[model samples]
Target: MKLKNLRYSCRHCNTEVGSIPFASAEEVIRELQRAEEGNGEHFLEYDDNGSMTVRCICEQCEQSLRMNPDYYALRKWIQ
Candidate 1:
């Protein structure tokens, strides 16, 4: 099996944010374990092709969110 990493992008601005590689099943399990231990704010998705995607906010969006907290309630700001 080949490992694949799908980078996350800002849902509003389409900026690349972060990535996680599923090099092995164990690695995927480890990530899940870590997520379960935390508050589980991060977004994760799995595709039928075996790729994993981790959604996160970019620095610019972070600043925008800090400046305008109301954007957090919108589903999409740029579209």
Candidate 2:
């Protein structure tokens, strides 16, 4: 099997945010590898650049990002 670079979708919000900034497919994979088979609590999205937009979301995260636009960093999920 190949350790392919994967695009991750936000578990909370359906947005396009990848993981180039986080670096390494392994780095992203490690975060949610233990949740379950095919159930990644976190994810990485992709842009036209082939870069990724990483996202990890629980119910709290969804509510936090949605309720407070002030959390500009969280805008990643809202997208």
Candidate 3:
């Protein structure tokens, strides 16, 4: 399964765009389920379908998102 987004907005840069992200619905569901279960502590917002709906910026944006694993877990808790 492949996950593609027709539109996305960068979480940091707010750049809205149509882009094809790393494709894998199985991976996404697994990751989401993991996070939702509070068992996964890695953050790859770009690696998921919901977040992929927002365009991921370039390597420069990597700095901003790299430290958010805990935040991701918190988000899952809230969700």
Candidate 4:
């Protein structure tokens, strides 16, 4: 059996938060497909090696966003 990998990184800063090894992609695909309608593309990505990279916000970025809610108006907030 082949192992599947799921890498989580911060969308704003590209900081790698963590990774998990999955027995199969089935579970991950199912969960990602359940994402809000057409917005699934924003969260899921397949790398060159076929591994999945899940775009997510890290703690630092999340805190920054909370401190500066206006940053949400910009497409890329980190400056």
**Clash-forming residue pairs, model 2:** 8-44, 17-45, 17-53, 18-52, 18-53, 18-54, 19-52, 19-53
Candidate 4 residue runs with Cα over 4 Å from true position: 1-3, 24-26
Candidate 4 lDDT by residue in tens digits, 20-79: 776645687558657835787888877666577889999999999999999999998777
- So what's the TM-score on candidate 1? 0.60
Q: 8-79 in candidate 1: lDDT tens per residue?
A: 777568677766555535566456547946854457655777665556678888898899899878877655
Q: Which candidate is the best by lDDT?
A: 4
Query: Looking at model 4, which ten-residue stretch has the lowest summed lDDT?
Result: 28-37
lDDT of 4 at 57: 96
Best-to-worst order by lDDT is: 4, 1, 2, 3
Q: Which window of 10 residues has the lowest lDDT sum in candidate 3?
A: 70-79
Task: Candidate 3: count the clashes.
Answer: 3
Question: How far does residue 63 in candidate 2 sit from its true spot (Å)?
Answer: 5.9
Model 2 RMSD to the real structure? 8.1
Which pairs in model 1 have colliding backbones?
none
> lDDT for each of the candidates?
0.65, 0.51, 0.46, 0.80
TM-score of each: 0.60, 0.32, 0.29, 0.81
With candidate 2 superimposed using the best TM-score fit, by how many Å does residue 17's alpha carbon deviate from the native? 1.2
